[model samples]
Target: MENQEVLQQILKELQSVNQRLDKLEAGQGELKDNQANIENKLDSVVEQTVDLKEFKTETNNKLDTVVEKIGAIEAVTKENLYDIAKLKLIK
Candidate 1:
């Protein structure tokens, strides 16, 4: 009778261990799914960062061109002002 009780207790402990293992397996599956989702989000952020860098470079190039054109206009305006002043002095 004592041996039967021991066997029953062992069986109960084994079942409890099995339940714990099942819970751990379920948790591992959820962790894997969450990891996959996080990786996908990271990939999207990397792509957007690349796009933003390219846009910034293009904008900087456009700004540089505009500055160069403004410099040219200023030089021409100065030259025209000098000519107008000399013409007025001669008159």
Candidate 2:
């Protein structure tokens, strides 16, 4: 009778241990899912930052080109005015 009681007690302890292990596994799964979501959001933020930097560089290049063209037009206009002044003096 004593041996039978000991065996039954051991079986009950094993069942309790198994139940705790199941709860721990469920908690671990939730942590993994949360980590995956955070990684995805971080990737999106990095991509947007790269796109913004490229747009700023392109706009600056276009502005530099426009300034160069305006300088050239001013130089030509000054040369034309000097030629006209000489013609008036001869007449």
Candidate 3:
């Protein structure tokens, strides 16, 4: 009867340990899933950052083009004014 009691106590202890292990396993699984989710979000952010950099470069290039066009127009206007002055003197 004493041996049976000891056996029953051992079984109870084993059951308790099994329950703890099950809870720990469940927690570890959840942690892994959360880590994956975080990594996916990070990847999306990185992609967006790259796109923003590309857009900034394109905008700067367009601004440079506009500045160049304005310079050319100014030069042409100056030449036209000089020609008009010369024509008026001839008249």
Candidate 4:
């Protein structure tokens, strides 16, 4: 009878250990899911950063072109004004 009681106690302990192991497995699954989500978000952010860099480079090129055109216009205007002044003086 004593041996029977000891066997019952051992069985109950084993059942408890099994339940704890099941809970740990469930927790590990959740952690893996969270890690996957974080990696996906990081990838999205990296893509956006690359896009922004490309846009900035394009904008800068456009601005430089506009500046060059403005400089050319100023040079032409100065030459026309100088020619007009010489004509008035000759008249």
User: For residues 1-91, what per-residue lDDT tens digits would candidate 2 score against the true structure?
Assistant: 9999999999899999999999999999999999999999999999999999999999999999999999999999999999999999999
- State the weakest 10-residue window (summed lDDT) of model 2: 11-20
Clash count in backbone of candidate 1 = 0
lDDT of candidates 1 onward, in order = 1.00, 0.94, 1.00, 1.00
Tens digit per residue, CA lDDT, model 1, 26-66: 99999999999999999999999999999999999999999
By TM-score, the better pick of 1 and 4 is 1
Location of the lowest summed lDDT over 10 successive residues in candidate 1: 1-10
Q: Which 10 consecutive positions of candidate 3 have the poorest summed lDDT?
A: 80-89
* Model 1, global lDDT: 1.00
TM-score for all models, in order of appearance: 0.96, 0.60, 0.74, 0.77
**Which digits, one per residue and each the tens of the lDDT, describe model 4 over residues 1-91?**
9999999999999999999999999999999999999999999999999999999999999999999999999999999999999999999
State the RMSD for candidate 3: 2.5
Per-residue lDDT of candidate 3, residues 1-91 (tens digit): 9999999999999999999999999999999999999999999999999999999999999999999999999999999999999999999
> Positional deviation of 68 in candidate 1, in angstroms?
0.7
RMSD of each: 0.8, 3.8, 2.5, 2.1
Candidates sorted by TM-score, descending order? 1, 4, 3, 2
TM-score winner between 1 and 2, please give it.
Answer: 1
Among the numbered candidates, top TM-score falls to 1
Off by over 4 Å in 3: 77-91
